[model samples]
Target chain A: MSATTNHPMVRFEGVTKRYGALTVLDDLNLEVGRGEKVAIIGPSGSGKTTVLRMLMTLERIDGGVIWVDGEPMTHMQKNGQMVPAEPKHLRRVRSKIGMVFQHFNLFPHMTALANCTEAPMTVLGLPRREAEERAAELLNMVGLGDKKGHYPAQLSGGQQQRVAIARALAMRPKIMLFDEVTSALDPELCGEVLQVIRKLGSEHDLTMLMVTHQMGFAKEFADRVCFFYQGKICEQGEPKELFTAPKNERTQQFLRAVLEAV
Target chain B: MGMFSLSAMLVAALIAIAIMSLFGDNALFMSGLLQGAWLTVQITLLGSLLAVIMATTAALFRLYGAPPLRWLAVTYVEFFRGTSALVQLFWLFFVLPLFGISMDPFSVGVLGLGLNIGAYGAEVVRGAVQGVHRGQWEATTALNMTRWQALKRIILPQAFVAMIPPWGNLFIELLKSTALVSLITMSDLTFRAKTINDTTMQTIPIFTLALLTYLVMSLTITIGMRWLERASLRGMVRGRGR
Candidate 1:
């Protein structure tokens, strides 16, 4: 595997994403080392969430390439020429990454266990018994073992978010992305969801990218923090330094506004 | 309330039978009409099956297929929805024979009704599928599901529940439209009614019986579909309890 430990788990090189005349992401260059925990924080519309979205392949990049595990993800090198990755290539690359959304987007028709097991059985070609076993373990890890038979609609917002985490973990992804995962939950329920993520951060050797508004959780859990402004990473440092002694004027103002609101 | 309605309907039906008995040979009328009704039932059951197949295929094409396939689906839905069902039926029954592609009257009736309603039903299916939340699509993609697998497992099942009421409506419309097939000599209920009226000149009683038969069939379909909707919704209701 070419000494996988030496390679960055994810690298974004001069990535750009635009919508019409508005540039959502502008020549972004970022890298996360293996097993690193990175948190993205910024004002809304500053492209904090876009960073995770582009990595998940949910949004297309207008320019530049993203590399995962030292392999080009957004483009494939074909015959010495870089071309947009084919669907097959995209699927293969994306399988290494898992994402949990703000809405907890669990399949309503499926029970929590089924939702957790679906990707393992369908995409990875794991047998049903093995997939179920893996899903159960992940569910238990997320503290949702008792809710496995419950459908998304039956679970509370916190429970559903936990199931979503387990579902993503069941895929055995090398990298995990969280896009405002606790944003939709009530303030009282947000802690339960954050706890699961905190546990993952401490226990797993997985690269994690999170876009979050929970300043306290980000400070406590993230190894490094990036503050984006106007589609660029305006400031980044250790979470303690970034949160407490932010140097950039924009990051200072953004943090002040957020802290005042809370 | 249910018992009252049932008894009221029974009394009204008995009184209507008493009046009809005074006019014509009820036995002969029923025998001829029953045969026609049987044929109508056959057409409806088969045509509805065909319509569901066509509608789902066209809807999937319109939503996810390549540009050319989407164009074809849109063309079909627009053309059929724009025109009258009668013209489409006549075109199938009378026009296609000239091309040496002849179909029996029964096949024409089923195809004519099925295709016409299928076009309308396609819109219902498309709307339901589109109404599914965007988050569901994102979740499937995040799970690394292929487009086909996503539709088959995640998107379509949720959409299918939304489609039931509308499909029920379309099926009833298809059932009623089957009466039009009588024009091409398929001898459905309407056709048999006309045959009875032609000889006996009992227009009021014959047409009335035909109308009542249609009402009964429509009622059955409505009730059956409502049961299906409730069954499908049971899991959702249970889930909401949390």
Candidate 2:
């Protein structure tokens, strides 16, 4: 529908994900523009996390193709027909995307610096010296420079999450996915993590898709907000418009419940 | 080795010394048992090494191999673990000789016990690898690591710490089973004790010495395993205390 250069950084074309008979993401179609920050807000079981997970290829798509950086991530072209992707195709397409989990899943056995350097050295095939230098810079960027030699267990929840962000950023991925990253942190700790994310959104040109329950942060940080309800986008628009005046019944009810809880 | 518990080593040393002192009146008998004990130690070490290799290979095969390879691994694990070690040892030492594949008694002992204990160790490896959190695998995937890279660089290292205690138990079980090798006429500690008993009818001192030596050997395994668990855990957890 537009110039190839104007294509979104990510597109979910009729994507479906299911667990047995339960459809989690039902024939979903969503597009995220390059360098845009899109926040997915929904109630529990709305498939918000699954959307991000499918893009990361952590979950299998039951039906449709997921495109990343203008390439099919879950399939490859063979004989002019689409087929399930080979490992080489999957890996090459996947390198453009990185994810941060809610649990701050740092490699426990490695120090912060090593955690960040591991992928750069092994997957990206960067030299150890350069990897360390890049990791050090990213760790410092996340404000954990002094804790580079410390293991993940030694860091606070906020500190570990910042390191996780740095580890992801070290890969230089164009699209970053965050799956309820602040859900596991303390209320005070949430700010530090959100701040780091906000810094990334503002300072870097990367496109980001975050599944967040933090409505305020979502409103402030996101260019567009998609309110998901029962595996579909119920309402979506500029953050201010969607937050201030929502038209969908489910979105209205969900926001009201969240506000009441707070 | 540096991280090994000193008190455990000291206790083992004291037990050996006390057992030796009790044999003061029978120095020749003591030397014979000691020599046999040394052979048992060697057999245990080599057998344990082989068992480790078999366990890791079989577990990986069972977990990640294709259909045929998976079936082969499962068969090996069940066959070794299901049958009696004594029968397996006899089959290897006796049955194979009749088939014109005679091996040295030492080789039979090592092979039989290695294959036997490794079966039990396969489950240990699998359980430990599976015990690692699912999040670790997702993190590795997000980093663009291949399955092999994930297993080698992340999964196995974490699993190694979890597996050591169970491997320690298997090793001790393997050490105890070395006595079964004497049935194949391998001249381990048990064989020497039996021979000495037949001649001197000294079941009291000779059998007692054999039991003490086995205890010492198993204690060494336990201590060594504990040391390994700690050394692996140090880099993961020691950032807090020191």
Candidate 3:
């Protein structure tokens, strides 16, 4: 919580991730300051999602290390040398981050209220009454207060996604990663989920990293937009500058393709 | 509508008349058969409880235990599934006594039937658990839940619904398999029926009565399991309306 301005909230230092010979992220280095809203945009296979996933600790790093809050995330110092982190170390670091997925992976067996409260009660050791109170507040914030008792199957894709966001926020994570959260929703429904995220972006001091296909939202909401291509950030800048005037040819081509599709 | 189905009422009346007529000639014999049938029920109930426990343990070992424990589970499942149930019963009843492990006939019957059916039930458990969507696991991990907590709270409850129907089949199979316990001198339904057959020399009537008794027990299991399945899935939206 006492993050100094000099130290970025999240830093990827020469981070490399690979699946056999296919490198998903190649010696990538990036940094996000506290409360910065960064959007990642790219064509499929560009490794935009991989960057968010690695930061969430959902994927293993092939080489190099990631730093969160100035501490190494993918490794721990052993005998003055960096070594791959143990599961205990990973869990301790991972508690600081929360992620929302494209599919809105809400537990279908649980009600929306239960889904939001589960992590707080079980993972954070909060008393049930306190967890329920916090979960109710989060559900209300996400505009699903009335639907708290409903199961995921009873909710629309947008509602489910919104509940997923609430569920993540209930943990009070320092960093929130959104991986194309609205991609699976219908065009009309995307607005509601995006609006909730927008409200959070403006109202909270939480650092946000998003991988999204919604270029318009990215332009409006992102402090900085990073354009990824072939597992590297080809270009990045303030949203207005990056979208309107691109210095990289790949970025220009990708934006044209995406805009034409829309 | 009446309290009972018309067909069920008709069946019940016919059974009462038949029993009354049959009772006049075979009163003592009918009473003896009823005692045997009660013993059969007792064995079935105890065996099923044991089978469920063994199957869950074996399935968990197969799914999440260390490599050596997994191998042990696989070996146990394959051995019991591959061998004949009758042979298994005979081995437990006849062979174990030779090794200074003398179990009573009733204990042998329960152990053999339970272990045999549990092996098949173990496969059912494994399939249901694995059938749970991969997204559920990812969701649990994202919530920072440990593997044990996830399995207990999310995965297993979902798997329970999928497991019920197949487990019903295994339960009935176990019930039918209990008849084999008669060979080891257990005074269950089949044993009593055989003893009566020896005395009365009325093969058709005695065996027919035994067959009907087994049918009634099997039907009860089917109906009871259906109720259990519905109760377990009561809150979930997918199967609720149906």
Candidate 4:
């Protein structure tokens, strides 16, 4: 199969975000090429999660624009003017992007199958039977085919996160964002979820942006590794060069602390 | 003057007897008490049903409707909670004619009782709906649910479990409030006792029956509410999954 194309699937142009007085993302300019797997690593407060959250539309940007598949994500351009994304515009753009949250915020009342099928039936207007069939296939891919009838509480944290990944993927989204998908799982359970994600990165041609602390997975699965510090990309390169020989001092310091802790 | 304190002293002793036995006497006095108690239960059951419906609709309007409808909900709740039940009962039974609307004494009694308890019930309902977790909202939004869909399928089902306790308390209070409906000529428990007192010339025995009847009504409501709570919470436990 062919690799990523030169065209960008996701791009942020001078994007900035703030919460009250604190600036969480400061004028970030980044792009993920079509069908590429990019891993973002950073210290605790380095805003890696914010980048993924922005792509998910869970948080809004304070300034600048984000483009997805050559269309602006946060707004629509009309007559050379940028306007707030109308409901229709947002729905169209959002349908192409899918997100798996850090906490696996599954609907506690729904079984795993229902969780995966809800959006397809509701937003995509798919029939219930069709949605369920698609959901079953996605569940099998995530190694959760038999757990489809179980509620979120009946599953372990790792199982719930894996189900969340299937739920995000069921939409057949062109781009996927994973924000700390394994951070909430136990150390022993993290590997299974990480393995599923690594399998997705290789098997699917979809573009993915992942924020994680798993250095080994980042080095193994990512086409590019970005080390972020203080809301800025401090260093970015091939995973081997960035992890073993990062050019920036801040990147090295952050890596040293993360490595020592594990 | 000597007769007044004498009767008061005698009634005080009867009050002590009433408290000690909890009015469980099986004598003729208890027979009169039970007849009155039955009427009280009838009024409370019907009145509380009306109250719960009104309270739930008002709470929904306050939480989901436009600003004007929300204001109307607020105004309705405040008007009932602000006025005494006696005054409201009087207004419903007597003053409704100014607008050319008239109803029977029983209808007025139910309306007065319902309107009064409904005010308190609305606050309870509002609090229950707000008690749903914030993360639930996020999950619903991520699924692209409309606001009404989120409220119906996700929020309100969770809120129903929380609303029952406060609603049960209001039901007990409603049992007592039905006594005010007697002044409007409904012949509820308090009215029955007053009629017996006039004909039998035995004020102590009649009023004592009324007190026992009120106790029975309140106890029945309390027990029934506990049963309903258990039934409703069973469903909630299944959703929460232990």
Worst 10 residues of 1 chain B by lDDT: B233-242
As for DockQ, the candidate ahead, 1 or 2, is 2
Residues A135-254 of candidate 4 have per-residue lDDT tens digits of: 999999989999999888788888989988898888888888888888878899998899898888889898989999889999999999988889999889999999888889998888
Worst 10 residues of 2 chain A by lDDT: A1-10
List, residue by residue over B1-242, the lDDT tens digit for candidate 1: 24356456645665675566566477569778879999999999999998999899999999989999999999999998999999998998889999998999999999989999999999999998888888888888899999898998888888888899899899999999999999988999999999889998877778887777777677667767877988888766522312
Q: What is the TM-score of model 1 when looking only at chain B?
A: 0.90
TM-score of each model, paired residue for residue: 0.95, 0.96, 0.93, 0.81
**Candidate 4 residues B1-242, lDDT tens each?**
24345345545655654664454332545555557667778888889998988898899989888999999999999999999989998988788977899998878878889988998899998998888776566666555566677787777777877777688679989988888877877667787777766776667766755775565555555555566767665423433321
Q: Candidate 4 chain B — worst ten consecutive residues by lDDT sum?
A: B233-242
DockQ-based CAPRI category assigned to the predicted complex of candidate 4? incorrect
lDDT of 3 by residue, A1-262 (tens): 4646579999999989999999999889999999999999999999999998888777888888899988988899999999999888888898889999998878777899999999899989999999999999999999999998998888888999999999999989999999999988889999999999999999999999999999999999999999999999999999999999999999999989987887
Best candidate per TM-score, number? 2
Please give the RMSD to the true structure for each candidate, in Å: 2.6, 2.8, 3.1, 7.3
In the range A145-232, model 1's lDDT, one tens digit per residue, is: 8888888888889999899999998888999999998898889999899988888888989999999999999999999999999999
Which numbered prediction scores highest in DockQ against the true structure? 2
For residue B198, model 4's alpha carbon misses the true position, in angstroms, by 4.3
lDDT of 2 by residue, B1-242 (tens): 34345456658766765756565455668778888888898889999999999999999999999999899999999999899999999998879989899999999999999999999999999998988888899999999999998999988988887888899899999999999888988788999999988998877777877887787787777877888887788757622211
Better structure of 3 and 4 per DockQ = 3
Residue B170 local lDDT, model 3: 96
Model 4 misplaced regions, further than 4 Å: A1-7, B1-50, B94-96, B99-103, B197-242
